[model samples]
Target: MISVLNLNVQHRGAMSGVLTLGSLDPAFEGAPAVDGPVQLDLRAVDFVEPAGLCGLAALLELLTQRTEHVSLALSGRNVAAYLERMDFFRLFGGRVEVHPDVSSLEERERHNPGTLQELINFHTEEEIPRIINRISEILKGKEYLLRERVAICSTLSEICANAAEHGTSSFGAFAAVQAYNHIVSGSRRAGEEVIISIADGGPGIRETLARNPQYKDHTETDNEAIRHALEMGVSSTGELGRGGGLTLVAQISARSGGSLSIRSGAGRVTVYRDRKNSRNVPPFPGTFVRVSLPRHAAEDRP
Candidate 1:
């Protein structure tokens, strides 16, 4: 019998029917020994964010390793079209069988100005500079202030660099960035926002930090490791001036009145300007980062 794994899109909540990084089920993360066909059912999904898109890509990479026949069941025209715009099918379309044909959506895909950077897969640190230069050029054509552009690009490069350095995997890494006209998923407030996300299939934060004996206490739990990672000068390598990239990225987001969230293993943490919140979540096989940067409207800006 074919095994069916539901994407578990939330039914009711602030993120109802929306797939985010945390929406992924832990079952798939643990049961990678499958020898039979597997179907990822996402028909109930209505929307997806940058985090969700990258997470989904990472999950598919993991599933493809265990089984030959992988089917993706998707519903909703809007969601399908959005995925097409983000080049999801271009990356994985040929890899999986789609229940309902989405070829039409792919054909109709048009340039989305809000898509600062569509989902991209990179294998090494060398690939990141090109990605950064491309996104920087895109930002230049937009109305973003110089500082705003720097913050977004810096946040992206820092996380992408971290993923390339510590989270290297056979599948490499995935990154995406999008600007929304209004606050859609994370918060209830009204304002324009930019969401940047990156995910890599490397060893999780806990295992990476555990590599260094000094982090034994901090690596006791996934949450502890993630929280410890946010601190300046914390990394698997005990070298000076290293491991401060993520710290600087967090500062950039906080200064913009935005937040940065990181997830790996079973821990997820979100950091804001004034405080930080940490929680235990479903196990994510890789390190995932999401940054939210709010864009104040011209009328509201001083």
Candidate 2:
């Protein structure tokens, strides 16, 4: 649990315990107090999103609470972005220290996307297959097994296609396609992370899924609709879903050690946290399902 590390805090091997990246220097107190600055190697780190940033801010406050003087260093592209956000900056109050840039956070964010993100306002039902195929192809050439690759591809296709078919049908196909295409064009905006939010003007998932005769109007059960969808032979698509798709998706996720999230009506949101995030997830009103899994690791697990 105790060892010297660079600024970035790479484990250099498999880790056991949870590593807390508090805003303050975790080791400033116990160290011998070296004269020269400690070069924290943060190159291995990616960005922490708004949610994750909240956790980091909480840790910083905890440090302030527990200790007297904890030196603060803002390095890495991601750490800087969190600091830049108005919402995140509120964690440290109005007067936040604008430190010198250790790495070009802006430049790095330009090319590499972090694990979990939302691609709001870009994708449509008609083009769903194309994106799923593209991601599958990316996974195909990787070091993962062929079966795992196929599983990820299929699960993504089902979740997204269902989201589009059911969620966007009310908006007319052409308009939906145009709206989604716009999202693809502008993947990067100054203050926005690309996220896809698909909302349907039709009946919500609760109203729709419970209509299935097999469900027997059991709306009160915990995660009933979602669980039924994950059951072996439940299909909301009627003829389109010959048997079970979401079940397959859930099984694949469970086998791969990934996560799946579902939000129905207005009061329900279920998030299945995989180790990381993937390119697919249903986000918005109606029935929204988002699957955030790594392209390869999902297959590498079990």
**Which regions of candidate 2 are displaced past 4 Å?**
1-123, 169-202, 266-284, 292-302
**What lDDT does each candidate get?**
0.80, 0.40
Find the candidate with the highest TM-score and give its number: 1
- Model 1 ranges with Cα > 4 A deviation: 12-14, 26-33, 112-114, 137-142, 185-189
Candidate 1 matches the true fold with a TM-score of 0.90
Give candidate 1's error at residue 155 in angstroms.
Answer: 4.3
lDDT of 1 by residue, 108-160 (tens): 63755744788999888899987777666655654777876786677577678
Candidate 1 residue 13 Cα shift, in angstroms, is 5.3
| Candidate 2, 155-244: lDDT as tens digits | 666656665556443331111100111111111212111122223334455566666765666554425555555556566545554436
